[model samples]
Target: MSKIADNIESTPHSDLAKGDEHSVKTGRILVAIATYNEIENLPILVERLVDTLPEADLLVIDDGSPDGTGQWCEEHAKMNVRMHCLHRKGKPGLGSAIIAAMQYAIDNNYDVMVNLDADLSHPPEKIPELLEAWRLADSDSTVAIGSRYIHGGGISGWPLKRHFMSRAINMYTRWLLWLPMADCSGSFRAYPVNLLRKIDFDSFLSYGYSFFEEVLYHLKEQGASFVEVPFQFVERQYGSSKINMRKAIVAVWTIFRLGLKAWNPF
Candidate 1:
């Protein structure tokens, strides 16, 4: 088991300090979002997130969006003291952007890191809830997943086919990989920064949208404890989804390969 996971499992839940409560010490949290061509949604997302979590810092990782998302973030950074931006030269995948942001959070010594979508698909209002889940569990919990498959959660804008596909994917993943949480594909999540640092970022191989799934699998193998919080997913209002048949095929292939590897150790 990973050192962090071992420590969490060993510690009693009742004794751990709850950071989410108003009485507990408010730790420095970095809310990181990976973006590409989200210029239209950037401002709205920033505004809502900032309003929701004024104490937490916001970091936007833009991968050379032709729509000038980086420039927009730069302008916003000047106005909002807690907002920062990282600009890349070309379109790197979502997974790469998140890795870069996570590395930055670790390097800066932030207490926690929250990853979400800039398209507003993941509700910005639930930031506190996810953070609370982590803090309440103390440092024992490695990840808090904002899940839509849970009882109080569901998707808003997805078509019937997409919804069916998502449900099937999650079900297959659960049966195949034995993932602990309900929504393994959900993007909204919170991580204890110190625990995340324990993951060897250099060894992480996934660079596509499937990175989230890969990270969860790795953490599970390391015995990381994951808590699921119900979240309502709202479809993006502004930009087109980057998902295509190619990405879907890649994700399925990756999941199968990883599942096999997990089941059979050479």
Candidate 2:
């Protein structure tokens, strides 16, 4: 049971995650997804996840989405013990939501944390690939990145502008921050609980898309080892993207700020 607030809701799913069922006794894994108005995607996503990785625990951090996402999660959680939801006051930044997720995972005594998009773009089926990578990582490994720029990774259904923007942002960050890895701008990542506990998340720089890049840089700089898993990036099937010109501009500028901070950590 979760040691969180009273509003925290849970129930036993028809399928159990423990005992003589699963072939692998993967320790407590929390798939933390942050959501705003992911009504259309959440249901199907949860169903597939429950069927796919029944052993994984799910935590949904909803930012007061008026679309009844909170209520929907509450209802589904009633039947699914693995499902957990955190209701925030309003639409907080994605970075803040992720911070909340990290705290939740640590507080609840989970071993591994995979934070990804609530939309199906991140692919729930590939979750085991991530966990497998994490499992195989060296003792020093703390983060595993779902990279789209690697040899076996690519993108599908993205507009030319989106592709160009993604490539450009990564290129910009690479030259400025000296990141050798591809796809630092992406959100699909896994972190070990003990490793994440060592970082100072309060000092995270970006609150939007750049948050992905900033944290990547910070973790690498802190001597954390990482593994890259190639996965195709896909466009969201439902709802509009939240990124706007303002967020993009902020992301660009944050890259330089990150670079400067790296140069002089004072």
**Cα-based TM-score, every candidate:** 0.88, 0.89
Model 1 residue pairs with clashes: 19-135
In candidate 2, what are the lDDT values of residues 82-186, reduced to their tens digit?
Answer: 787788775658877787788776766677889889888988888899888888877645588898999999999998998999999899888888787878788
Model 1, 1-266: lDDT tens per residue?
A: 22211111111122112222222356778899988899999899888997899777788887778898888887777776677777765565777777777776776667888999989898889989998898887446469999998899999988999999998888877776778889988789998777777777655556676778878887777768898999899999899999898998888777887788778968
lDDT for 244 in candidate 2 is 94
What RMSD, rounded to one decimal, does every model reach?
A: 7.9, 4.0
Stretch of 10 with least lDDT, candidate 2 = 1-10
Candidate 2 RMSD to the correct structure: 4.0
lDDT of prediction 1: 0.78
* Candidate 1's TM-score: 0.88
Number of the predicted model whose lDDT against the real structure is largest: 2
